[model samples]
Target: MKSKIFCDNTAALMAAVREGAEGATIEIAAGVFELEATLELKARMTLKGAGIGKTILTHVAGWKPSTKSLPDPEMRLDGLDTDAYLIRLKRDTAGITISDMTLLGPQLHGAIFAWFPTSLHLHHLRIKETLWSGLRTFGMQKAKIHDCEFVDAGGRWDSGQPGVKGGITGGGIFAIWMSDCEIYDNRFVRTRTGPAQEFYGIKVRQGTRCRVHHNTIETNFSMEFPFENDEDNEIDHNVCHGTISIPKYAGGVVPKSGRTFHIHHNWMKDSYALEFVRNGVEIDHNLFDFDVKQDHGNLISAFGNVAAKGPASFHNNLVSNPGRGVIWINEVFNNLEIRNNHIVTRTTTTPRTEGLFGFNPGSDFTSIAIKDNLVECQGLARPLLRAPESYAAIVENNKLTNVSDAKKLTNAKANRPVGLENPLAFRCGAHEEFTVSGWKVRPTKK
Candidate 1:
């Protein structure tokens, strides 16, 4: 049934909800409510902000709780208490829908970090202008964010000191911090922090499969972030603006343990900010923008992002005015197939050693293949810009405009990287294994 709770008191509204029955609607009146802490969500309840734009839940920014000091790959930013995630729903809080409310995350870790399962829907809402991140998710499945706006404030990660880890991690409006999310038809705009912390429209960690489609990711000075350890993800049909990174962030689309990626129909803009990456991805129908030089993060210097991590494949993509025709592996990867791709190089003519960075792995990229791909460069360019010193694989049959741009890179004084040992292809908990008939990543230990 329908219910209206008018009054600017959030505590009173929460008390009302605690006193009310399950599946009741809590229609907050149009006004501003100052929240001191997180307003935890109830089971099966719908929190509809009064008329979308009229009601605002302004939070008083405060100190964040620390999660980890070392910044491991798998830890969720929950403990950080960085920013106040406006609302959170956890454990068996099924069938919840939040609509038309502008949820603002204070300058903490993230605006929203949820661990809810069993069908959650976020519709027609706008989450923007936060500090750490706009929206983040973990261990949530069947969740949907649509007709929403994740406008970036451009909070870049803490990088570029004598000892910084390459920009900062948070900021940006919508970061699906963990895994198993679906965001579609959303509008990401403004993106204030050009090439700072935000770096992505939506990103995921490991052990999740997300479908990001029909959305607009526009950035003025941010890099589309890294999707590390995530698997079975699909990014498609999104109209992107400004400058965005290619492939699926950092981890590529091949989940931490699975094998496959579906990335297509994405239009990207190019930036010359310079960054580093070590991802091995296969993209299709994606449009990459052009820049004076494409090495934004200095992956060449760090030598972590240039490893060859493919024997995989992605085909039929469009590259318009892209910097380089083909950038070979800089890291170590095994098995790859790169074909049927079109490339138009050189939008900017500030000529240097630019146009597609080729392989430069220090060691351990085994079994790879490349064939039937179109390659074009504006000036005298070489296909093999840089080859690694010790790769277990080889490169061949790729089209090229110039051959001398071909080069190799290998430095003995780089950080020797590490990866998870014997990662899982899929995993499950007790209830999830019980619910879906006979799909098991592992049997119950108990």
Candidate 2:
């Protein structure tokens, strides 16, 4: 293995890059640099900062955004294009590990990203003031983001265009967009937008087989963190916190499975809106805490729905002092299984801890089973009624405890009757089974 190569400026770095072969480890010393265009790395390169603590790269204040500047909708650029960066790659830059640097994205233009790239590894870095996304990955595989921090991103939140999408500019509205990639061990705070608007911390879309673990995704003003429309992804051991700010919308985790999404062993706390639509949801060994009751419009909740149906499998989870229950399948669906969960709801949250009154499954769901769980009904229980679509909901052999209010139990509001007369004691403080940030995002070896 070779020792190292040093570069003073981006031009020198590009010169070394052009002269080097595959698998080059370029050690960049701590310095300020300029970037006018996208640096394409065709080979596997490890661009290491002298030290993550000492290395620094700053860019020009970039393009300012608005309809006036970008007359063309085809413009990829978004806000003040502080897109000039320390280093960014385009085209087949695989096996690349970028470590230890404070790379700045500050421009008076649109999105700081003048170029879009695919397949890269970013480790131990800090990015501030990205006009669009902090990191833009088109469609990459086997890439990882580790030990990074994004502070006060998604700059300059105006009333975006009428149909302007999320994670567009300045505000880090969009960070890390890709497929089959892993985003773990990162921090996003004060990554905000305008008054009633917070932006998305991490967005997963058009991606598969991706895992998001051990990240503190919080403190934005416009939208939800981990905004997921992506399919067949695993979101485990993540802390989803803070006031989810969207103007006319509510934010929540939707099980996009059919398209395929599996949610297991994750903590959902201080959340605004979470929904499930058109998917098979496997919710197991997770904790749901809906602490702040600031009213996300309709009702402050851990889980709420617009189109709620689950080919939904919910088991082995715990909900304590939240604003709602675990299952709120408001629409119709097949195979709704509820098992082995500790559900606790205050009287101020909903009517009962477990019931079929508010959100029910579709009539076509014939397989609805509730077994081996401790359920507390502060107000009413057994308001479950079956839909006319054709279904069955059976409750058997479980501990239904602390349900003393007799006026809350009525007959069949939405599903079949299985009201338990003999119940057991319920516990409130049950967490999950696995450790946090279980996957490694950065590999030390080349």
**Candidate 2 RMSD to the correct structure:** 8.1
Number of clashing pairs per prediction, in order: 64, 47
lDDT of 2 by residue, 1-446 (tens): 75357887878876766676667788777787655554444456777887655776554444233333321222233442222334555444467667888766544222223133445677788766544455554446777776777665544344366655433433342433456777777776663445423445664334466777666666542223233444666666665554332111122234333524556555556534344443444666655555524323111222333443445566666655444434444444445677676665555433333332233443344466666655665444432322333224554544555544323332123332232222222211112222322111122221
Best-fitting candidate, scored by lDDT: 1
How much lDDT does each candidate structure score? 0.51, 0.49
What tens-digit string does per-residue lDDT give for candidate 1 at 39-91? Answer: 66666778788755777765765544333331213245534452356676655
TM-score of 2: 0.68
10 residues in a row with least lDDT, candidate 1: 430-439
| TM-score between candidate 1 and the true structure | 0.69
Candidate 1: which stretches are off by over 4 Å?
1-14, 60-78, 105-110, 153-167, 171-180, 194-199, 220-228, 241-258, 271-281, 292-302, 305-309, 354-357, 361-367, 379-385, 388-446
Q: Which stretches of candidate 2 lie over 4 Å from their true place?
A: 1-4, 9-22, 34-38, 62-86, 108-119, 155-177, 191-193, 219-231, 242-259, 292-309, 347-357, 360-362, 377-392, 401-446
